[model samples]
Target: MARNSYTIGIVLIGVAIILLLGKLGVIHFIASFFWPLVLLIPGLLFHMLFFNRTLPSGVLVPGGILTTYALMFFYCNLFGWGAMSYLWPGFILGVAIGLYELHLFDRNTHRGVWIAAMILGAISVVFFVITLLFKLGVYVIALVLVLAGAALIFRRPRSW
Candidate 1:
């Protein structure tokens, strides 16, 4: 019961903070620039306070919540409703760190493996796009190299 109440209180506080910012048009102003980076300080503090020495599930839920917030902010920016342009990179970085932490729990886990894999996969996709646009043979080589790197990383032991 106490835990439930605490959880509800935290949720309410978060909502209240957002509402206060919205009501004051602070979010609108902050979104007008790269001020969203200011979120990193509290985010880091929260991680240090609650996530240190925690299990994967503990980190995952909060990480997901933060990622969702980031996405919504990004969407608002993309739609011209906000001003921040570098939101997605922060979101990606947060998710990458969370995934890496989660991977720390299990020796056989491949969760963090997707972080690198996704980057390489994106490179391949970009190369494919370039190949379509310019008929570039070099992009094919780039794609192959990216895939090889991903494959090697995936196949390597997670013991390190």
Candidate 2:
């Protein structure tokens, strides 16, 4: 099939580049960095297959989650494992994204699906922000507390 050949050609090109890079001695230390692409390629391929009508649409959820998780792993791989502390919310967000994609593209989507996606996505965003602030250190919390106290102390009494 044309699609299969196209995928294979792209894969061959990728391998060729990696080999070239390896021969140049630039890939030895960074070979592990490419491992996540293994996940990303198949994940993206599933979505593409769905679009190309070669696979059932049900694969979208797995595809989206895999793609999101692969990116998350890639981020951690590049930034260090400590990045996972604040990036943990990506797990929930990935599922929420898949749900959103399903609800948006599926004609028979249920109202509950949208509601679930909104809830999960909002929680993930909030958690990520809070965790990131925490990782940024105690200064942010102290500043918030100081601002709140100042606001409270400066409040004027309401006229009766």
Candidate 3:
């Protein structure tokens, strides 16, 4: 009976601590900031397994992908989700990174994998450029116009 009472008391204390932490927002804080670790841990495990020879190089594909995505998520979480509009290209880059890793680490990798990785990487770059231009293009255009106007005003031939 004494052992049972002690166990019950310990369990109640543990529950109370958990509840207090949750109420204090500590649990939410950890969950929000460190949730990317859920993806990162498995990704790292895959890499470690490959390095240890417990898994084949094929695992690197998902490993690279997950790690990249986890990093991207962490960035968004730290900054803001709005940044994802510009960072969406990172998704394509993640696959490209995975394929590149496979090409680099796999002994039996083919030329096709390298080509695919390059194509995807190029696509990601293109998307990033387009997104940036779409988002900040107006500011750039405004600056250019202002500069052109200043140059015209300062020019010697002010007749026109």
Candidate 4:
């Protein structure tokens, strides 16, 4: 229980830090390639060191992959990398992760991870669909998805 709380706190702190960096416009100047690599390294290390005991290795691998893609997308957007093409890569990675979680990972925790990934993957799909259907409004869909994700994370049961 304590470890779960610590993990949740760390995740929230990480999110807060990213938001703060964005608000300060520090993320805008960072190179598009750098943020994903930077986030991937520490994210993998932290998963290995702190979360390994709680999360399965298979789940961790895909989770880290998704995180890397997400960081890449964020960095691309912040640095104005033109039309947000990185989102496609991120969505692909997310769907791959979800499939891996659903098929390859046979663990007690697989259900939760798979469900979460599916929800996120659906949101990503929706964003892309909306962008295709009406190019100017996709950002609003993404924002809504982010808020929903944040709320889900914040309200997640600690006992699990």
| Best of the candidates, TM-score | 3
Cα lDDT tens digits, model 3, 1-160, are 9999999999999999999999999999999999999999998999999999999999998999999999999999999999999999999999999999999988699999999999999999999999999999999899999999999789868675
How well is each residue in 101-139 modelled by candidate 1, as lDDT tens digits?
A: 445543466654556636744654555455454554678
The total of clashing pairs for model 1 equals 1
The residue-by-residue lDDT of candidate 2 on 25-139, one tens digit each, is: 8887676777888888988998999899898766777888889999999999989988898899999999898888778777687888889989999999999988978787588
Question: Can you give the lDDT of residue 100 in candidate 4?
Answer: 50
How would the candidate models be sorted by TM-score, starting from the highest?
3, 2, 4, 1
Task: lDDT winner between 2 and 3, please give it.
Answer: 3
Write down the lDDT of every candidate, Cα atoms only.
0.58, 0.88, 0.95, 0.64
RMSD to true structure for each model, in Å: 16.0, 8.0, 3.5, 21.8
lDDT of 2: 0.88
Highest lDDT: which candidate?
A: 3
Enumerate residue pairs that collide in model 2: none
Instruction: State model 1's lDDT.
Output: 0.58
Report lDDT (Cα) of residue 104, candidate 2. Answer: 78
Q: Would you list the rank order by lDDT, best first?
A: 3, 2, 4, 1
Per-model TM-score versus the true fold = 0.29, 0.68, 0.83, 0.38
